[model samples]
Target chain A: MGNEYKVQVNHLTKKFGNLLVLDDISFHVKENEFLCIVGPTGCGKTTFLNSLSKLYDITAGEILINGMPVDLKKHNVAYIFQEYSNMPWLTIRQNVEFGLRIKHRPEAEIREQTDYFLDMVGLTKFQDYYPDQLSASMLQRAAIARAFAVKPELLLMDEPYGQLDIELRFRLEDELIRLWREVGTTVIFITHNIEEAVYLSNRILVLTNKPTKIKEEIHNDLPRPRNIADPAFVELRRKVTDLIKWW
Target chain B: MNQNKNGTKDNKKYILMSICSVLVFLFIWELVTDVLGIFKSTMLPSPVKVFGTFIDKFTNTKPDGATIQVHTLASLKVALSGYLIGVGIGVPLGIAMAWFRKVDCFVTPLFDLLRPVPGIAWLPVLIVFFGIGLLSKAMVIFLSAFIACVINSYSGIKNTRMVHLWVGQTFGATRSQLLFKVAIPTALPMIFTGLKVALGASWNALIAAELLASTKGLGFMINQARGIYRPDIILVGMIAVGITGAILGYLIELLQKLVMKRGWRQ
Candidate 1:
């Protein structure tokens, strides 16, 4: 059972000075699972994700990728920040190739991966455009392509589409789902939007306010191409929404 | 297309206005000195007299021991040498200081102590060590430019966004790779700004050192004019300095634009 899980977080705890942000949170993500985490505003969701990526040093407990302890040098991880993390100086093609280059992949593999991801995100035509030249949605697409090109074992996204309009958000969400399906990479997406959690994840983890703990983890068996207006989708969204309401 | 046409038209008008303003200023100076005779010729040379002196100084070397071209070249050589040395040393030292904690701890205290002392204040000590030769003068200019380069480069590296660093780390970048590929590229605009400031400072320091100590150079030519009470010669030296400084600054700006064509502005 332990080996079956890709990510096993055991009693993860984090604090800033005297203020406790995350308190004894425990969870496991199956291999290639699409897990979405939703919580109330200021519920330390970002802190939790940051801890998993070792961006924030946890005060206690451990995080494991596979059966071994999580080590950035040993494991492959990719993060998509709320703000666009595309290197402004690199063109779209170069940006997509950045991680592969860092990892010292074979030249042919780097080009093939970069090309595949760029095409997947529909950015092949804009490969020469710098991040500044692209529109907001296009910039996010470039970021996505860059992340996917790395073929990371764990993909952590922190409200990556939080700033986009609803229409663009849905479009990118669909693209994300398609990419996830094809790539089969384990994904842990953190968002404040309940509908987003319902629309994307195989399972949703609802977290509590302040000293955040796992309120519940609801398994989502909703079929592919989920409709927001579907009764099951609405029921699941409402359940997650009810669990996250703090006030 | 219409907006670009309007922009070009406005740009032309501005150039015309700039030329007219310079002419008007020269006219006023000529009125005060020659036509009105409000001031003696020795006190303020007329624009025409200054113009004549500019041409005469190029051909005549009696007043300064060298032609204007030779003096200009000497000044430029000394200034550029000091400027390049300062950039070569200061930029790397600054980046190292920002990137390594041990380097920062070792260098910061000494740097802070010396930072407030003006570059010209080192003149007496430098002259004593190196004597009143080109070396001493170049050292002063080097110190002046070095301070600007060190400060800007350090800040530039220190101010790279944490998010950028995190992204680099996630991709399995080594410490050295992060510094070279992420921090340095991110710091380029500030590095260029430092280069510009250092350039201007180098020029100022060069002129000051030449005026005080050198036997040849633009500063020496101006100082010689002062000794001989040739206001026209002094006016010519001042104009030359102004034009050369503007041209150097413009060249740096052009280089910056050429390198940053891919929207580093973002």
Candidate 2:
């Protein structure tokens, strides 16, 4: 049996008491696919990710990874939240190595992965600094490095660069793409920024407000090293913006 | 290097100011008692006389059974033993109560019931069970410190950020690993606070315990001074308790600095 999809969300529905949040959402993320989920503000985007991560128990349906139920112990899943998730007490190097250490990887492998990710994220110089001492962008970079160091089978990012400035976001997005291409891990990134969706995703999943359901699944076939100023990039960005525009 | 030098200079200036303030206070105390004769010599002795008694007690044991240093050491032995026992039991018990529902259910009701009862109130019961010796006094100090440690440790573990736990769980941390690695580390700052509170409480309770039945402690010395109508000896005992308490608090703060490594002074 061939399982083409790395993640399969089968009729996922979630409710908080009587209030419905996610309404029968179904999607498939191919192996190593960079899938961006974009929606308007207050559109249950976080709820969707929580359900996928099993942080919240779904009211109906199941989330499968590689033809099996999503079991955290059996499969490696990583999440990068918008808030700086670096443990404040740990140094940047320790933060990067946290996931690997939790998984009990070999010491040599842990050191190797920690160094590689820290270098890739351009944080090797500040590896000894605690999270509180670093800038906001640097903290996010550490979070990214930590997530990637584990070599996760599935990576979920919830607007990880939402608080970052435009220039820093672009730079980090480039680093993220580079790491993604190098590692080839399936990613489900949720954000409200249409340009960011068009810029980073291989495919964009647009969602509706309130009880969020898939509005559109637009395939993005743009060339690598996408330019925000490029007319083609602008066109795709506008298309996604139009689909999710509530105002 | 320049900043370091400036910091040292500022620290020295603060210490000098603190010493000057203490001297002003002592001068006022001397003025009221010795110079103006506002209170009787027996009621309020001059600062010089108190200092004289403090120095005399170091060498001579005429007033008390033992010297001030020996008395302090005896009090410390009882206080520390009980305080350590309290920390040993309270911290792990508090963590368990916070983390596990079964533990909380079993411990919280009884803890709440005992928490309101004063440590001194237990003196009679402790003396009856353990006999009026070092054990009874130590048990009293233990009870006082134990409540503070348990409450602080419980709140510490309870207040662990949800996101930190989520991060650990997402990374495949086992239950024990999450408790030890994530929960415990996150709870350390609060645990330190608990230890400091417990230390002070134990010291305060030690006075009451010593007042019951003891021959060699600052509290016993104070009681003995009152019986003999020697206010100078009482003053010396009070000063000794204050200085020792301040020193112990400072030592605990140092331990907090060593353990946390976050540069949090308070």
Candidate 3:
């Protein structure tokens, strides 16, 4: 059971100057688990996620992926941020191929994976368009397609749809679920939206306010094609919101 | 279809207006010099006299000892050599300065010290070191273009989006990969801006050096005409300089368009 953990964070601590942000937080994400980390706004959720993604150096503690310290050089980790991070100079197709090209994957493999993901995200028709030429939803879709194209061992998403409208957000959330199920990679999705966490995750990690710690880890064994309007969904979301004491 | 026809009509109208404006300006200039004779010919030669001198100098090399074409070729050689060399070195140095802290620290003090000094101010020192030859005058232009290219390229790389860098880092790209794949391409528009500024500076610096010390070039031709008191030749030389500068600027703009036309923006 212990060996099955895909990601292990042990006493993750962070401090910006004298003010502590993440105080000795520890958690373990299981293999192929869609773990949603929901926290109150301004509760250092991004800081925690950034640390986990190795974008920021944690002051203390360690992040382990497949039972080793996080090393981007050795591990395949992909990240989708709150903002559109696609290189504006590259077309949507080139953006999707960026990581694969960087890793020097075989040409045929790169083309195959790129086409599959771009088609999967419904961006096949817009492949030649630049980022500025695309709408917000398409841009985010490009980011998702780019992340999944690498077939990452671990995928990190940080409020990737925070800027989208509710309709677009739901559409992307569903696509993310489909990708997660198909790829079966370990997913760590960070968001402040409780309903979003409930709607997408296999398990939800509820975080406390500043100097954040894991308030609770709830198992979300909700069946497929889960309805957000369903009573069970609303009740689970309420339970997470109640834990954070934030409406 | 109507909108397209109207747009074409508007463009033609603008072109016609531009031609008319130049004609009116030349008419006014000719009137002040030739028709009224209010100002002496030496001070401001008539447009007719200037145009005659322009054509005559193309064939005749009496005053400057070199035809207009020869002077122009010489000037192009100096300007282009200094300009290209500066871009080749300055662009890479600037990018390195921005991406590497050690390089930035080592080079910034030298850059800051030289930044305030005008490129023309280096002419006397360069003449002393290399004499009033192609090397010396080109060195003056090199300094001017170098500063511009470095400033722009450095600022361009520095302006790379942090989010883009993170994307590269997360995807397991190395430091050099982040630079080439992410930072440099992202910084391209600004780097082009630097190239444009560098071209202008190099041209201006070359002219100043030629006016003060060169034995050839449009600037030297103007200086030689000034010595012989032939305002016609001077005016022609000035016109040549203006036309050449505009043409060079247009060429740079064309290059910019060609390089950046990867459908970067609408």
Among the numbered candidates, top DockQ falls to: 3
Q: Report the C-alpha lDDT of model 3 over A1-247, residue by residue, as the tens digit.
A: 3467889999999999998999999999988999999988899999998999888889999999888999997899999999889888899999999999988899999999999999999999999988988899999999999999999999999999999999999999999999999998999999989999999999999998898998999999889899999999999988988998855
How do the residues A163-193 of candidate 1 rate in per-residue lDDT, one tens digit apiece?
Answer: 9999999999999999999998999999999
Worst 10 residues of 2 chain A by lDDT: A82-91
lDDT of 3 by residue, B8-51 (tens): 99999999999999999999998898999988998888889888
Which one wins by DockQ: 1 or 3? Answer: 3
Better of 2 and 3 by TM-score: 3
Candidate 3 fraction of reference contacts recovered: 0.76
lDDT by residue for model 1 over B212-252, one digit each (tens)?
A: 88989999999999999998898899889888888889999
| Fnat for the candidates in order | 0.59, 0.44, 0.76
- What DockQ results for candidate 2? 0.53
What is the C-alpha local distance difference test score of each model? 0.91, 0.91, 0.92
Best by TM-score: 3
DockQ of each two-chain model: 0.67, 0.53, 0.75
In terms of lDDT, the best-performing candidate is 3
- What TM-score does candidate 3 reach? 0.98
